[model samples]
Target: MVRRPTERPGRNDEPDLPPNLFVIGLLHDLKEGGYSRHAWAAFWRASWIRSIQILEMSAELRASWLRFSVTGIVLIALSTVAVTAYFGIGQGIPFALTSVLWWGILMFDLAMHLGLMVNLESGELQQTLGWPNRLTELRGLAAVWVAWGAHWASAGVYVPLVLVFGLAAFTDLLDGWLARRRHASTRWGRLYDPFMDGLFFSVAAISLAVVGILPQWLAALVTLRYAFPIFGGITFLLIRRRTLRVRHTPWGRASSAGIALTVFAAALAAALGLPFQALAPFFYAAVGITALGAFVTILIRGIEQI
Candidate 1:
């Protein structure tokens, strides 16, 4: 027996999509008499009308998100200011400047996002803040928070800083996994996600050194490992003047994992009052592994260029 052909989606034989809630809510002001007089004509024209209506809704939603995000960042900066003032770091004034600098950086990044947003058509706007991008935003903002937290992090109060760093580190793995599973990877995300990861790790590494949890030499190694790839990619983006799609290299991934583990362990050990001297061997071994992996990644990338 022959089977009936399956109906393709979004064509004849498929049921109409439910109207967007934004459209329904938007039309609440319509008079009952008006609806009764033109309901039939409106049904025939609903598809075209709703498409335009949804486009407007998309833009409205985007505006609302932009407002929320900007306000949230401002609040973070203000809170950092209060914390800095309370902590008296850099006599309270210098750290306030740091907070300002952080806010400026955030604004610049937001500007980059806005530039991309303006170029998007209506459909792209609808999908702008999908699960993966939301994760990316979380990851990026958390990295900034870690950096700010480090500035105010005291040796006496290490636990909070450790918690922030740990959560930010988790977002790295999570965003990558979700992006792959959801097919929501964007070029901007590919660039910024690693940049944020590197930025957070670098900031955490330096903060550890500042707190004497890590020695200067080890901190240097960790910073360089993260910095090399980040600067190289930025340089490429500037020079190429086109879309750049850079995925994580295998060795790079291993390097990040190893470095994060070492940072967390070192911070935790310091917080627990464990002597850095006692765990010097373990910490150094991890650093060596991370450095070796990073070197191999660079060599592999260089070889590909040849």
Candidate 2:
């Protein structure tokens, strides 16, 4: 008598099962095993849950920082206006200058706190979003912003502010080096780092101009340091349809160092009440050359990529 296929037993199967029964059973087991574990783990993990919590926390933090930054800027502006009002208030020796400088300090503090928040946000985003080395970028930009604010505040003081500014400038370089050495370079950090440097330098130049410390021509050149790059960036974006990349170049590094040194030297001269005019020509020349080199580098690199 012939048994049906399902009724037949083979060595591959259990003694009670047919030949195809084992294959069917294995498939069924695999299907039942499915992705449930993955789903369950994702929902229950600390990292995932903390990401949600951090979103809310970051929102609150960003709000607080924005409020503080705005308020500080407004106070600084008002304090500057109070400079004229000092004469009206009958205060001796322009007490409003002190108020303005104090406002600068407040602004600096706010900027620093904002930077801290950025660092925290970058760190959280890295884990939550799979971004690499973003915290390093954030720290770089933060260092620049902090340095800028310190420089502004120092401008309102004598030599003490310059020392603080110098320290901050040094930290900006140090932070970038640390980031690279520590393997913490990220896209966000790269973009923001140079952007913040441009902003800081622009603001410093403008502040010096406002205080009559920087001659108008030299101030214009300093301002162009930012404007030239920004214009190039915009042009490149418009024409080439590519965002500028931050390449490590010796000339670029030297240009930055030169500009920083020039600013320090100028500040020192101002503090000493010495004639800073001789330094002005050299400073402007350095700025112009650097700006030109940067522009050429960006333009050439951008075009070559296309």
Candidate 3:
């Protein structure tokens, strides 16, 4: 018996198929894959692509800055060694080590600013703008290293270094305000801004600890603000397979401001030859309260998401 035309196998009687059957089949396979497998693949792909792009972009962007960086580093190193030997040989080096350290920091900051500008302009021109996570990561690492160097300088010349630290802190505030006011804010700025702030505070706390200007407990408390949140963020991303959305929460901003002020106060007290121990209790208390507030805010937000 002849089948009806409409009912013939592989004819219009069959379910409609995609014109690009191969592409459709591949997409279907992707969706059917386990979530973890798909997630890992996506993560690795994103990370690999980002690394390649950042390396290429950074090479172009930092060419001039790298020259400056090398020159500055060499000069600073030579100055440091010379000053050390002179001091050992009973010839006062006329300049504080802290000054050299600050100079190095300023140079590093200039390099970073240059890199950031190049990256932002390139992104705009290419219409490839998005959050620059790799650049942000690099900036964060740089901040931490700078802070470490600053702390060493502070320990060597505590009073003069405090001034440099204060100025650097102020620049952090100014840069953000300028970016916002000029309407030049970008995804890269948002990530870099906070990472720098955290690094600055963390480094300052380390400096204070080294000089016995702050109680160990106080320094630890301040460090925990950044450390705990960082850990939490990593955990969330691993479990949820997504980065936490950046938000400008009032409490978060307040916490950061409070931390900065506390560090500034501690530095001032040290510089003034005041008994910094008395302020330790207050510092610890402020850190605890701000940290608690920040934690509660994060917890509430996490719950809301659920």
Predicted structure with the largest lDDT when compared to the true one? 1
lDDT of 3: 0.54
What is candidate 2's TM-score against the reference? 0.52
Question: What Cα-based lDDT does every candidate model obtain?
Answer: 0.60, 0.51, 0.54
Global fold similarity of model 1 (TM-score): 0.65
**Global CA lDDT of candidate 1, please?**
0.60
Q: Model 2, stretches more than 4 Å misplaced?
A: 1-156, 238-241
Off by over 4 Å in 3: 1-46, 54-156, 277-280
Over 57-176, each residue of candidate 1 has an lDDT whose tens digit, in order, gives: 666545645665676557666765666656765534654565456656664464335323321112243335455555556555556556555554563767557887888788788877
Q: Using lDDT, rank the candidates from best to worst.
A: 1, 3, 2
Residue pairs clashing, model 1: none
TM-score of each: 0.65, 0.52, 0.60
lDDT per residue as tens, model 3, 1-306 = 123577556311211111223223433444455546775586456545544455456564455445545654565566456646644423223233444555566555544344234233223411222223323333343343344444544655454356656666666666655544444545445545666667667777776677666667766777777676667765664455444544445677677777777777777766677776676677667777877898788778665544
- Candidate 1: residue 118 lDDT (0-100): 23
* Model 1 clash tally, residue pairs: 0
**1 or 3, greater by lDDT:** 1
RMSD of each: 15.2, 20.1, 14.7
Better structure of 1 and 3 per TM-score? 1
